[model samples]
Target: MAKRPEVVPDILDWYAESARDLPWRAADRTPWGVLVSEFMLQQTPVSRVLRPWSAWLERWPAPAALAAEPAGEAIRAWGRLGYPRRALRLHAAAVAITERHGGEVPDDHEALLALPGVGAYTAAAVASFAFGRRHVVLDTNVRRVLGRVIGATAYPPNHQTATERDLAEQLVPADPARAARWAAASMELGAIVCTARNPACGRCPVADRCAWLAAGRPDNAPPRRGQSYAGTDRQCRGALLAVLRDADEPVVGERLDLAWPAAVQRERALAGLLADGLVVRVGERYALP
Candidate 1:
């Protein structure tokens, strides 16, 4: 196995040359841009986010800009990103940032967490990636990559554990700038090379030190389940929302009826959206909240 000290540097050096030219990671990117990217990226692919993210930043360059618009406008701009609730939450977060932090995205991690819809991961990510602060930004990619390199796991747990948190904290570099870079580097490595399936072991910088590789890349974990979207309530929800999202004004019941084929599933999905505050009743018409 490769020495622990060398593995970190190897990954870092590899990232220096290989990191994707994401807009959020650009030198000119603002804290607000990073925060917006974090919101748009939740469970969504980078490819799906790129255009929407650019449009969002263009329309609302800062927290104050988004906060100035109706919450529904955010939902309209969200496009087909799947989870429409995030649009409402992001609008709320923008209001909080404007009211609480004077239009600037908070630099302090705890301050970031205090924002509406801001969680531990989002807070740490904004702090580290935007402000260049030390933090364990352990998103799925970071967790997966480190699990293989350090813990020899074929896959990390479905949910992060206290043990994983402790291990990640210890793995973070002590220097603030380097730690921030490490956070982005590790996540990038996992995304491009050390993917969840079909990891390119030959291209991995730390392959020599990967405990999972040294152990012959055993699939010791139980078989993972894949999520089904077709014919699911989630698919119905997306369909119904698409009608409202595209309409110039609130849509009537008949409009939503054409969105989803099944009467029962359509009603159930629309009800769920209304309950989740992604949709609202405007008289008899339904519209984004």
Candidate 2:
């Protein structure tokens, strides 16, 4: 008989014994709760997502609650989460949910994908986690796990491509409940043990079957690109949004100038925010809409 699959069982068993008892994983977590958690988890750590997620679920509890409020509340609620744009997107998604799905997070993949901020990864995650659908839920952790388990690399060359998705789907266990748990478990292993740098292979459950170990743990891949944050428009945008989010009423252009030193970049950032619908201009003042 062919070699028994190692990663799935090892990961599931490890997760069964070791997975963190997160608030979102509670028995009473609603679909809205799952949606909010997924959005918060994007490019953010689980540690960071916890408190805010709990507070958000406690405050809103449903799409209608968030949808009824101004976008500024979401931005403020986001609070140092990094990538505040996701807050705006979540707010828009809430509005969309209210209008389209009668304030319920749709269970179907296509409908979920159509939400303002719900992309493929988030859509699949909600479907699997909330509804327990059998779908290949690929995230950064899952991608890295697959990379080491099969390709002997830290991560796939360029994220989840068609080939990568096919590989992930092939690895997903047949049962829906087990498959969801396996996806979360594989991600947990990659996050805590099979980390990008200085991986703790000894602690990894699937270390016995890891191709990267078989290949002598070589770093054959190029270093990932560094992001430029200083002097970028993103900083300017953040500063502008901070001012707007704190204000009770729309801010004048002159008021926004206090946030940034560069006038031109500040103007550009405010204009971009207006175009993005994150901010609305009333005569000369800007406020979250």
**Count of clashing residue pairs in every prediction:** 0, 1
lDDT of 1 by residue, 160-274 (tens): 9888888788778899999999999999998999998899999999898889999999886663577886899988998888888898999899988887879998999889999
Which 10-residue window in model 1 sums to the lowest lDDT? Answer: 1-10
Model 2 residue 75 lDDT score: 87
TM-score of decoy 1: 0.95
lDDT of 2 by residue, 41-89 (tens): 9999999999999889889999999999988899889987888889999
TM-score of each: 0.95, 0.94
Model 2 lowest lDDT segment of ten? 1-10
RMSD of each: 1.8, 2.1
